[model samples]
Target: MLDWTTVLVIVLMAASTYATRVVGFVVLRDRTLSPRMQAIMQNVPGCVLISVIAPAFVSSRPADLLGLAVTLAAAMRLSLLPTVVIGVVATGLLRHFVG
Candidate 1:
């Protein structure tokens, strides 16, 4: 039931994503990272996390905002699993009762 253009687009997207990941690995395989490069790499995870979280927090509704707040507090306390649990439960409960 799929059209040719749609299928081609999907295939190209998958291939592009795969190629990007593979290229990163190939490019870094034999390289010794300099101090600046190492520092950049060290910040990558935090940067990626902030990029994902920032938009969600900014665009979320009040209930989701509450859940995000709870999650952030738990995360600050270094309780990752509890943060995730609280976020999920708070969001689910709010959506169920309010929305």
Candidate 2:
């Protein structure tokens, strides 16, 4: 069942992604970002997270929408780690029980 070619491609993709991150750090090591740009960089991860889950907002599945609601509520009141944990658990339970 294991495809060696697919595995190789995945490994290469992972390596390339990691390489890019390292390269970016190495290139910017001596440079200081402007305060505004630093603030923007800090929000990039959250923006990426929202973009990833944006489709769930319009999903027809009750589990998806409810999970997103629970995630939003958790995000509002909790720190990132706890919010992520609560969201994952809530979504998994909702999907398993409701689907």
Candidate 3:
């Protein structure tokens, strides 16, 4: 049922993502990054994660907000896997009960 345009777009997107990573490795292969650059690179993933998730929070329903709050609380006290599990369970429960 997928259209040709959608398939082509998906293929191009995959290629572009692959090319980006390959280009990064090729361009940086012989160079040593500075400490400041390294620190910035280390934080990119977290910053990207926040940027992607922040919009969801702003537009979330009550159940989603409650789940996110529980997730945040769990994140403070637990590690990554537990926090994710807690978030998913809490969200599913809240959606079932509240929605």
Candidate 4:
């Protein structure tokens, strides 16, 4: 159902995103980061995650908010994979039953 212009635009966007990611890797490949830089890099993922999840939790209903709380507690106490699984399953179950 896509026209040629739409397909071209989508392809260009995908290529642009891929190019930026590749540029970051390539630029960093030959350099060694300092301890401070490494710490910053380590914190990036968590910061990004909080940026994404915080708003969702704030806007969610009571049951969804409860699931988010449980998920956050599990994440703090457990490993990443288990935390993600618990969060996803809890959210899905709560939304399904509550809605």
C-alpha RMSD for every candidate: 5.1, 2.6, 4.0, 4.4
Best by TM-score: 2
Best by lDDT: 2
- What does candidate 4 score on TM? 0.69
Candidate 1's TM-score = 0.55
Which pairs, if any, clash in model 1? none
lDDT score for candidate 4 against the true structure: 0.81
Model 2: CA > 4 A from native: 1-17
When summed lDDT is taken over every stretch of 10 residues in candidate 4, the lowest stretch is 51-60
**Candidate 4 C-alpha error for residue 40, in Å:** 0.9
Instruction: Output the lDDT of residue 73, model 2.
Output: 97
Encode model 3's per-residue lDDT on 1-99: one tens digit a residue.
979999999999999989988998899899999999889977776575456446548855888788778877887998666876787899889989987
Residue range 1-99, candidate 2, lDDT tens digits = 999999999999999989988997898899999999899978876886788678998899999889999999999998777877887889899999997
Better of 1 and 3 by lDDT: 3
TM-score-based ranking: 2, 4, 3, 1
